[model samples]
Target: MKVLIVEDEKPAARRLHRMLEQLELPVEHTVHSVKEAVEHLSNNTPPDLIFLDIQLSDGLSFEIFDHVKVDSAIIFTTAYDEYALKAFKLNSIDYLLKPIDVKELEVAVNQFKASFRESGNPIHNKAQFQPIDLQQIAKLLNEPQNAYKNRFTVKVGEHIKLFATDEIQLFYSENKGTYINLPNGRNYLLDLNLEAVEARLNPKTFFRVSRQAIVHINAITDIISYTNSRLKVKINSFTTFDLVVSRERVKDFRRWIEG
Candidate 1:
């Protein structure tokens, strides 16, 4: 039986491949990131199995299911235990924690083979993420409400300050780190990425104008168009910055705003 490995971390993928080799299983292929996996699955026949990671550099492994059909068994590999618990509740056949154990790897593979014999296809029906997770994810993708604003208090210095979502005009990434531009006339570093914060915020008051920046709808002073299918947003923020809406995400963002 052939197996495909889908993981973004290079070392982890190599290690998993080595362990599977020890199992003497035929390896079909391996790829990193969600985009690469999509390309592979779109063109090639389904492998006998897939060892998938929960998180990719660009998106969640769950997104893979949306783009392609895979009847093969899947064993999720993640570092977080909370996700592992949820995976079990989803009826996933098996999962292995990071720094995968040889014994555990063998056990999961054995279970896959046995289940494949009994069920014909190892997957029950392509694992489905719970609705709550999907809703939270959608909220993260578009405009957000102010629900997350007052609940979170940050300690910026010797003083503990609370900044409401309405006080924040924009969220931007600097050196791959996140910072908040408050309309209250200050800029502060944020605890999480624009992605995580977007998911928790209610989707009525904020909009992710770009992959690295989210602007409060109330913060926008003007909108500008760019040459290459990009958008330039002028918002009431700490500084003047260029927000580029990616070409692939343009239509989705437009529909989201209209919807």
Candidate 2:
């Protein structure tokens, strides 16, 4: 299969490429931004399948469709909330949430093969696939009232403990494991990764200061200037680690904190 991947993060693109390689499906082309993807699609033959990310470095990947007509099948790889991705499900499109699972990736690829490959040529067959409504999806994403998690449950030996969003100071990932830091300096291990936690928490209340940590707005006691143009966040009680805002996210972080 001629596969193309359009993802902004190079590490994420590499990880997806490796996963595809493990499934014996080699990626023929990988582009980082919307501009690169549009240029490649305009010049070369459309790929049989495209692993597309919703957000790109330059702009939304939906912009690519505006620039060129694509007949290839697409499977979205996104960090968007489940509600935001519901449009894809309704449109009969498959999507893998961030920190893609290997088994799910295999299933999506197998399903694509069954649906498209079984019918002969996978490209230039508009009838076989539902036309993706990019405008409708963009509209769905812009809608307000997205449901966000207000509480989390964690196992404490023989029982489970429920912690409200207000009780948590921060969520961080370390040594390949995710943990929730509480106001009393207690830390509980979370089953989900940092990305999954970030997706569930309300963005208004929780801001991902860095890939390693997401801090509750009310929990932040101070913001200090840091090296490399990054900002360091101080949580009310969780001082186990330094919560530094990534350089790229500093501008957005400042705006979010101000509100």
Candidate 3:
């Protein structure tokens, strides 16, 4: 199959390419950022299939469809769970969560193959696939209430402990593992990764300060101006790691804090 990958993260794009290679799928090209993707799609022949990321470096990948017409089937790869419902409205064959599972990838590819076989020419037939309707999906998604996780179950040695969402001060990543800090001055290892944790928690209460940390608004004791237009976050009773929000995220951080 002629496939294309549009992902901003180089490492992730490379890994996905490698996985497709292992599956013996032909990945025609890989483009990072919305501009690059748009340019490529406008200039070159559209691929048969695309593994696309929702959040690109410039903007949402949805912006690409606004600029160019796409006939290829899309398989969305995303870290945020908020867009899950919207993804299916597009010509998405499947939606895969980040830290992509090989088995899941295989399954998604199989589903695409099955659809192709059944429809003969799946891309040209709108009945075989859903039309891309991003605006309506976005409007529906923006409706006030969103379901967020209230609690998490974590392992405490041999025993399992239930961690309440309100008790959590911050969620941080270290040594390739995610850990949750509580107001009671205790820390616990969590099986869910930082991306997963970010997606589940209430966005109003929790703000992802940096890639390494997601701090609760209540947990933030102080926010100080840091070097290079960045902001430093001080979490209550946690002093081991110094967290600084990246410069690019400063604007959203300010808005989040103000809200």
Considering every candidate listed, which one attains the maximal TM-score? Answer: 2
- Report the C-alpha lDDT of model 2 over 164-185, residue by residue, as the tens digit: 8778889998887788998888
Write candidate 3's Cα lDDT for 1-259 as tens digits.
6889999767678878998888878689999889999999999987878898876777778788788888888888865444445546453446786657778899888777787778854444334444546766545444445347667766565466777788899999888778899987788876556876786788889999889999999888888999999999987778769989999999999999889
Clashing pairs in 1: 143-203, 143-206, 144-202, 144-203, 144-205, 144-206, 145-202, 145-203
Models sorted by lDDT, best on top: 2, 3, 1
Ranking by TM-score: 2, 3, 1
Candidate 1 lDDT score at position 197: 69
**Model 2 spans with C-alpha error above 4 angstroms:** 115-117, 123-131, 147-214, 221-233, 236-259
Candidate 2 positional error at 147, Å: 9.1
* TM values, all candidates: 0.48, 0.66, 0.61
- Candidate 2's TM-score reads 0.66
lDDT head-to-head 1 vs 2, winner: 2
Overlapping backbone residue pairs in candidate 3 total 0
Candidate 2: residue 212 lDDT (0-100): 90
Q: Tally clashes: model 1.
A: 8
lDDT of 1 at 36: 95
* Better lDDT candidate (2, 3): 2
Q: Which stretches of candidate 1 lie over 4 Å from their true place?
A: 90-93, 118-120, 123-259
Candidate 3 achieves a global lDDT of 0.77
Model 3 stretches with alpha carbons more than 4 Å out: 82-93, 114-132, 147-168, 171-204, 207-214, 218-240, 244-259
RMSD of each: 10.7, 6.6, 6.6
